[model samples]
Target: MALAEPFEIARGVQTESETVIVELTHEGMTGVGAAAPSAHYGETTATVEAVLPRLFEVLPEDPHEIDAAHTAMDRVVNDNPAAKAAVDIAMHDLVAKLHNLPLYRYLGLDATETPTSSFTVGLAETGEMARKAEAAVEAGYEILKVKLGTDRDVEIIETLAETVPDARLRVDANEAWTPKEAIRTCRALDGLVEFVEQPVPAEHPTGMARVTEQSPLPIAADESLVAPADVPAVAEIADVANVKLMKCGGIRPAIATFHAARAHGLETMLGCMIESNASIAAGVQLAPLLDYADLDGSLLLADGADPFDGPPVPALDPTGVVGTGARRN
Candidate 1:
């Protein structure tokens, strides 16, 4: 899928995202999902494609046996979470459709009070980012997630804050700062931003804990919190846990991770890769369970670039929908 423009984050830049569509058919009903792999998590389109057939072989005969399916897939192979997520999402879509209910209804989630998603402002020249942010606000977005990590991170954020004073702002550093640098930057951004995300590397837990201990604003753990087992450690260092379907396998694991985060007393968030509506729609169904949402992956794609259509975003309304609402456009 082509992006509307180059999307630069602290880690790198991409002009297009490569995604693989996965489809499952059961009792004359077809459910669709897509894999938007992330190399940072050790998976790519090729890796997902390579492992999917094997994973498919282990799928339970019944869609409702999702936990069993996950165990079977894990036994067959180690990582390759994006591949597993594709299958898991398709199963959820299929099961919900079979029951004539929306995915949220099947999972028993309430959509009445879901938080609106935040539109991301990927790293760019300071002025260009500001222009994009202002344009997003004009286009009807009330919250923005700005990518930071540049030497001018402060300047870029300050510019956007001034440019759109009324817009809610959140900054993600994507593990770019040193412990000292993170603390200093977080203090500088205190009231100007909502929270700082993954300021130090996930491998450096001690560094993250130090930054979290000293930072003035809340700290969100993205890379630091990958699965349920990591929740305890993450809760000790961060105030918020950012869960991604691609990172933790899929909907089932995401749910488990969210519950674990809550059990450990960390605020929960759901984020996504630059994905298609095929998978993003599934994320939207889980919105009511989140304290924050960064589900603008599909919205970042160039118009008509996505091959599938799903739920509405920003608004994240799952009203009166059957299945996961992901179908070929």
Candidate 2:
């Protein structure tokens, strides 16, 4: 899918997202999912496609046997979370449809307290980003996640704070800053932004801990926390656990990660890659479990670019839709 515009982060810029859509059929019903693989995570369209067939072979005949399916897939392969995520998501959609319940209701999550998702403003010139922030506010987004990595990160954010005074702001550096730089920037923007995300590289755990210790704003772990096993270390240094379906596998593993985060006393969040509603919809179903959300992947896509339709974003209310509410347009 083409982005509405170029979406830049610290790692680089993307103009289009190549996503693989997955469809699973059983007993005359079909469930849909998609894989929005990220090269940063060692996945691409080819990787996801290559691993899916082997993963599918392990899926249990019963869609309800999600645990067994996951176990079998893990035993078959090591770190193909995006591929596993597609199958995992499809199976979840199928099970919910068979039971005639919305995905969240099937999982027993309350819909009353779902958090509003943050619309992201990818990196751009200071003036351009400010314009985007103003447009997002005009479009009814009260919260915004501003991408920051440039040398003028502080200037960009300060301009945005002025551009949309009422908007709640969150900033993601996407592991762009050095430890000292992260700490300095975080302190500089303390009151202007909500929190800072992945300010330093994931490879430097000690540096991340140092930044976390010094930053005035709460820290959110994105690249630093990829799986449940990383939760304990993340909890020691970050205030929020940013869980993504692509990063941790899918709904089942994401749930496990969230539970582990909670047990370690960290705030839980759900983020997404630039994705279609096919996968983002599944993430929407789990919104009640989140303290914060950044599930604006479909919103960033060019209008009508996605082939599937799913739950509404920003509001992210999943009250009455059956299954994942994701299907072909």
lDDT of 2 at 73: 96
lDDT of 1 by residue, 163-226 (tens): 9999999999999999999999999998899999999999999999999899999999999987
Candidate 1 TM-score, C-alpha based: 0.99
Q: lDDT tens string, model 2, 1-329?
A: 99889888998989999999888898888878889998989999999999998998878888899999999999999998888899999999998998899999999999999999999999888999999999999999999999999999999989999999999999999999999999999999999999999999999889989998988899999999898899999999899999999999999999999999999999999999999999999999999999999999999899999998878879989878889988789
- Candidate 1 lDDT at 196 equals 92
Candidate 2: list runs displaced more than 4 Å: none
Provide backbone clash counts, one per model.
0, 0
RMSD values for the candidates in order, in angstroms, are 0.8, 0.8
**Cα error of candidate 1 at position 134, Å:** 0.3
In terms of lDDT, model 1 sits at: 0.93
Per-residue error at 69 for model 2, in Å?
A: 0.5
Error of 1 at 320 (Å): 1.7
- For all candidates in order, the CA lDDT equals 0.93, 0.93
